[model samples]
Target chain A: MNPLPRIPSPRNPAPLTIADLGEQGLLQRLQPFCAPGVVGDDGAVLQPSPGQALVVTTDTLVEGVHFSATTTPPEAVGWRSAAANLSDLAAMGALPLGLTVALALPSTCSVAWLEGLYQGLAQCVGDYGTAIVGGDLCRAPHLVVSITALGEVPPPLVLKRNAAQVGDAIVVTGYHGASRAGLELLLDPDRALTGLCPPSPQQRDQWIRAHQYPRPRLDWVPWLRSALAQGQSASASRSFAAMDSSDGLADAVLQLCRASGVGAHLVQADLPLPPGLASWQGLATALDWTLYGGEDFELVLCLPETVLAGLEAASGAGVPAFGLRRVGTIVAGSQVTLHGSDPQEPGRVLSLDRGFQHFSELF
Target chain B: MNPLPRIPSPRNPAPLTIADLGEQGLLQRLQPFCAPGVVGDDGAVLQPSPGQALVVTTDTLVEGVHFSATTTPPEAVGWRSAAANLSDLAAMGALPLGLTVALALPSTCSVAWLEGLYQGLAQCVGDYGTAIVGGDLCRAPHLVVSITALGEVPPPLVLKRNAAQVGDAIVVTGYHGASRAGLELLLDPDRALTGLCPPSPQQRDQWIRAHQYPRPRLDWVPWLRSALAQGQSASASRSFAAMDSSDGLADAVLQLCRASGVGAHLVQADLPLPPGLASWQGLATALDWTLYGGEDFELVLCLPETVLAGLEAASGAGVPAFGLRRVGTIVAGSQVTLHGSDPQEPGRVLSLDRGFQHFSELF
Candidate 1:
């Protein structure tokens, strides 16, 4: 068998190894992101906010299975792990506070690589004011990093999975399919000229960075929470069912419906597709990517029809800024339907094979 | 090359895969150890006590590096992982409340095996009053389980590694070396008849169980807290430094000394050995294990001479009735010495070829 290929060191003045990185390296990377009350050592400490509850979530990334060793950088892996957990916190409209990371690395792994990974993780945490508090170190057959994040939600602001109602109008944040486009670029580099993948170095960098460090929608939490709390009517306040979309819009919408025990109707014309993909063929491909691609980390929300006014009021103030657009609505049935043109001629809802199945395809 | 040996299924029932066990089965198994507020879908929710702080810790166990697939059962691996983290909590005199588990399994791994592992983990959690809160599941090259446990301690009751003072007496809870002896038995099963190993089936079972599922000394937390609250002199309360002896007594003493900036003098004759291992050769072997073997999971505590009465008053009534012994005294310098009859003549301190190293060794 061929010997394992060595990972290249970052182009810098000095290189470091796993031992050299140590606890200090981790602390340096995470310290900037930590909130005032969260401290490091045992775990990130979150002082209880008087009227809020703490929301915690965890996600793990394994080498090879999650991403090929040759294709994905350690820094991207670190960033993604933090982003994934933060996404969960954002889904609950919670303020990200701190995180603990447990890392398992092969003995031969260099310290420099680990340090770079921390750099990426630190960048994300710092961006969101989340501290890297505590974690474990161990040897393993392959590289694995598990991160648990803690966030706080004011009692009145907590969004749960089971809060959607039959008449709720569904809205989503941000554009979709960019990460999926980036994935296609990585998997088939030759597909660049087709406009499916960007060709220039700058474009490549943008795509790669998007794949590696997609931001969590934490900034939108306050606006969403405020709108939900107004509570004049479902439409008067901003309250509705909300969750982050990680495993693509299709799966996320399906999950929301399942939790609410209702069905949904998707308006194809309302989707926010990325630039330059306009023709039906192009749109269909992009839609496929948008529907089932993973790691978008945006929010898919269900708002009561009464709260539509509150959502519109928030949008008018440029609060959500990108603005929430209606993509679907909850109905009385148990299946997600896609609407084309005429109400009498509803189009067949296109279903892609499962999105990202972590351990098994069963889910 | 020969194919890897298949994991053995128990004789009485066909092995169940993780899918077969589902969420409820795994939760049911883990429910016993967790307090009412511990488990939740988002993550375990722990309520911090008044004037108390939360202590969080995480550790991961991999299939081959942490345990041998053939020799160690999956259940033991799961149980020990929880035990190890809880031990850290106990060292701080904290009560464990909840834990989140992230599991990475190869696609071919059986669901039943995962169920058994959860059963073991759940048993330990139930025993500790820790709830299973939340976790991530993913596919990987080998089995990997990462657990994060949350614990609480009154601020005044928190014991730290840096509190040992010169002239403080060193105390240890429970007997040492049994785990090392059991490990020796596992490595060389044919040595069962030797006095170095357990002599009977019952003794052997006990030894193995102790190694596999050692209980964290959480019962001592309340007693330690009470001792702290009684306003004993600084020479008594402030002098106490505590940490778990996970990496054998000598190493633990070395770490405690490093943390406290002091040395210690151990009485070789006072080193407690497991019962029935008193013969000259057996005692020597047991002593070696006690000094250098890993995974004892007992507490090594340092306190002033004045608190001996308080400790004695609390023992057996709350603390485990087993071997709590005075083994050494803290000194002003930075050396750890083993003392014999001649206090003036320095005793020879034993050294091992290597200390316990994780992951890197395998690679």
Candidate 2:
């Protein structure tokens, strides 16, 4: 293992653990990331835009369970945690506002690790024009970073999982399967890049980066808002539904269907596999990665016929459309079915229990 | 140890671990505690009251560090976590709206543990009319609960630590030493109730409860709002400063003074000791506990003479005044001094390093 790279702190004379930077010192160092007049008070104050309803979500990442200390850097851990929460806000089609972090670290954890973690957090928030606000720091036996992100949306524009209806087009933004593949690359002992698996170094790096820094689909929020507004006219996707693929596409689709009491038939061929997967030696492994790989942080929206047509027409226009794919359609049932070659043939009906169960997966 | 107590869940038919409930099932079980229409969506949506400024605070409690599974019940663990964050809101005189909890528990942890924790959380929020808006649940090696509580306050009525003024009266609501004494009873291996120390069973229980469920002073928010409003007038206590005594009265006083760029002179004789402490054996021990005990969840306010006059006159009429003692005064210098007997003699000046150093205390 490599010795930790030294990250200099302009305030401290090369301190070791966070203990070297006392509570006040730590707060002072992290204050720059906070919104103005928000870091020192008992609680930070925020004023939402007029007629806006605030959207909030929290996600917790623990060492060893969520990420490996050996494989993933502290900064990436922080970035991913923030990204997970931001993705939830994006799923709601809300504009990112601010976030508060509750971080607990072991006494042996280095000050450099803390700095790197905050730097990553700062970078993510900086990109979205969001402030860190104030947060709590404490001691724990291991590392735990919990982030709560707050955003705002016009009340009528809020997207929900229970809004999906029959005949709605199921569309997903961005490519899928990369994050899970990345995890496999990092964890698989027999992988070529680690002198055991077949993948090249560049492929491994791309996959790993996908897992570490999954982009929260904030960029697609404007498009979603525009679609939602037009759909409210009773001629678009007025019964629209959307959710982020954090628990893998299959599981997330099932969740949305179950919530809305509808079924979905997703086409396997239409599923966007991670680039270069065609050269992979195993078909089953790649399929599994595409179908059930969690942490993609991509949006899956159910659009009515009118909105679907509009989106399809606007796809090649000024909109930032990359991996947007029309994968399937909502149906009148409770099962999620997947079709391979032909839609007329029998499809593979998937169960809710097939995907990532956070508790079961941890063990 | 006694076998785990049976806490029946009418919702689940004898579930064992979280996996049995599954993610959706678990969310459904906990949905009753959340605000209406807020739990099922990707993110909870909240509409803050018109003209209100939202206050947000997050606090995390870790197993082995914040509590012992052997000594503290899961309900108390949840209760304390909620209380800690709520206390921060009380310090700001904000009316709590809702809270989102991010819980990471071990896979082997019982379903009953999760139920008990939420039950306690529900009770706290119920008492204040605050809702459990939503939360995240996941797996960890140990229990870690992070809560982000949201509240609202009129901007003009916001309480701040940096608002303290020179010659202002330093007053505290409720006693402080009891919490530290409780912690000592819980942590000291040679304590009487544990068959080694001199304290009785009743005394031990009192301390344990104090440590486990420190009440947030939501009941006092109205009085604070009224005080802050009246103080806004030219003749009232315009230089008001306030914060919670989470890190002992001395430490909290020092923090308020430091933030305000002022000093404080506290009289030891005026410090309110917990009731029945006269029977205790040691004066210095009791004094140390009173001066440096953290987690008391009491409010310490620096009030001007005019505001103090109005508060004193209105105390018993409508306010729930308990242990409201004038312990000291804000001074001109940057030191916190305590006079044991006479002010003419040299006093004890407290340092910022005295209490609740999260990292240093852990080691």
Candidate 3:
């Protein structure tokens, strides 16, 4: 039998990795941040809330596809990974109950990086009043984080895509494209902003932060529910359909319309571009990016026109804080049309840019 | 901008890949297999069972790590992945409610392969009386499947790892070592059986089937509860602790002991070897593999001494079917010891093999 030569890694002496800690040690590191008494069990036991239904959403983020390992901070990657799932639950008007993070790590991944990643996941989950209840760890060629977030909402308020009425007002909770721009800057920090009407350094930094740490719209849910409830009569049932624009605004709009069997008329002039975008539209194409770029983690909602009057008057809570902007209306046709600034002219059918195709595309 | 020359393939214009389908087309493919009315929404809504606590567990299986892309069939891969997580819920004595499957696929993955994978996943999930409630798909350099299984159990019967008493009898449902031996054959089908005292062809086939299609002990759960209840009077409380042997029997025993804060005395003669393992113990080291080799997917349980007499008499349903074997007894201490066939000899401390460390090793 021939024995292979052993080559010890001595030159650079890289940082301590998860491999060095082993499963038990790595679990020990995680137990403190995860939900108390949840990590040691066969599975996390969550008591069901009476009269409420449970909502579950899952999302996966791969190392190179979702965030560049070398360029992006580990904690920010963790934050964004968790935010993606939490945003889905928030879109359904469910408050988070807990989360289970399943990670597949590479041998080269450092323990410090893992710690920072968990810290980010825990912080985002904790910020929304939930804990990391359970998780599984294993090996892979690259880093992969799959988070399944469990949330709860009353059965009546459990939002669905098909609930939008024909006379619904299309709304957005916040600005868009900042996350895409942030991603561009992060990928090529010194270069991606060279086009006409580049964002200021401060604006670029904000965009970077938006991309790195986009918060889920969980805080806006309670306020919206309360605000909408106030406007309706005692016996009238009320509902507003919503979906997160993680796959860009156009994609979300198209999905909502398709699911609801309705059409949407998006007004160009009323587009809620990130601050200062209206002034700088020529060479930058920021408006195009704003409408098409994804990962904003903002909710695109549809409120019934009848309740719109009441909701507008019932505001002050979630209204000013999240900057809910009325973008368009749900029309009768099935096509999503974009109307120009001129009121007399007919609208053009919006072309669909395929968003985030698995196996072929990346963010 | 110079466009790269399009090199068209003339020979072997391969089958339809997931890239050709895109994300929307892929969702359309998955919609039917997933839970009815659960897909096409921001998140899945599950009506919580009355008076039942929810149990959640997650597990991941990566290509080349958990399953071989070339050797293992895609459907088998899917079945094994779901089984891994389902086993966790089964160990906790919970009835599955639903599951969320998040997959990260490579460009090379074919749509046919994906359909088969989902079919396998759906079959296993459906067999256990649940559906794939939600899922997310994205691009990755390799095939990755992360499944989060949700379950429900009455609060009192929420089997946890910490409920074992000092005098509890350690029991295992079904056999062990077959999964490891099966893996051995699958990895090197031609040469793995060359060692001393290899099994018959039928036995080999059985072992391989065990590896590819191991079922979760969900069927045994109901019987377990009823059996334990039969011994206790109307007033006395009854419960047992359990954990899956996915990380091998020894690892499961060690973990159950560590989590419950009790030591165990494993009888060497009483170890539940898979059908032909005890006979093939010399060069093949089947007993060693039985104890240390992981991915068995059987449940290791701890039943109170008082209930043992009743449970033994309370058989006929899950007993003969799954071959429930009593292998050890829980003792007061922190160390897990293995006693020799000669009961007079003092037992020796069992050395830990550090089962299934991520990023460092693979089966």
Give the alpha carbon lDDT tens digit for every residue of B1-363 in model 1.
Answer: 222123344342655555454443444544443444333333433345555566767888888877876788767777888888888888877888678888887766675566557767777878777667677777778888998877777666677777888988898888777787777778887677765444666555556666887778887777776665663544344535788887688877877887788989899888867665455237667677778777888889888766655776765455566846899999998888887778788876543223454522223
Distance (Å) between predicted and true CA of A96, model 1?
Answer: 2.3
Model 2: CA > 4 A from native: A1-15, A187-205, A235-239, A311-318, A321-323, B1-15, B185-207, B235-239, B312-316, B321-323
lDDT of 3 by residue, B1-363 (tens): 212112222222458778887777878877887889867987899997899999999999989888887887767887888898899999998889999999988866887788878877887888788889999888898888999999998787778888777888999987888888888878778744565566778777777878988888887788766665664454267566899999899888888888888999999888878877656556247777888888889989898765665666666643666567899999999889888778888787765544655644542
Q: Which lDDT tens digits does candidate 2 get at residues B228-314? A: 667678555454689999888888899899989999999988988875553463667777788887889999999887777666654
Better of 1 and 3 by lDDT: 3
iRMSD in angstroms, per model: 3.7, 1.3, 1.9
Docking class of 3: medium
Q: What DockQ does model 3 achieve?
A: 0.55
Query: In candidate 1, how many Å is residue B7 off?
Result: 19
Q: Which tens-of-lDDT digit does each residue in A140-228 have in candidate 1?
A: 77889999887778755677666777878888887677677777778877766665434555555455555777888887787777678
Give the range of the ten consecutive residues with the poorest summed lDDT in model 2 chain B.
B1-10
Candidates sorted on TM-score, descending = 3, 2, 1
lDDT of 2 at B309: 69
**What TM-score does candidate 2 reach?**
0.91
User: Candidate 3 chain B: worst 10 consecutive residues by lDDT?
Assistant: B1-10
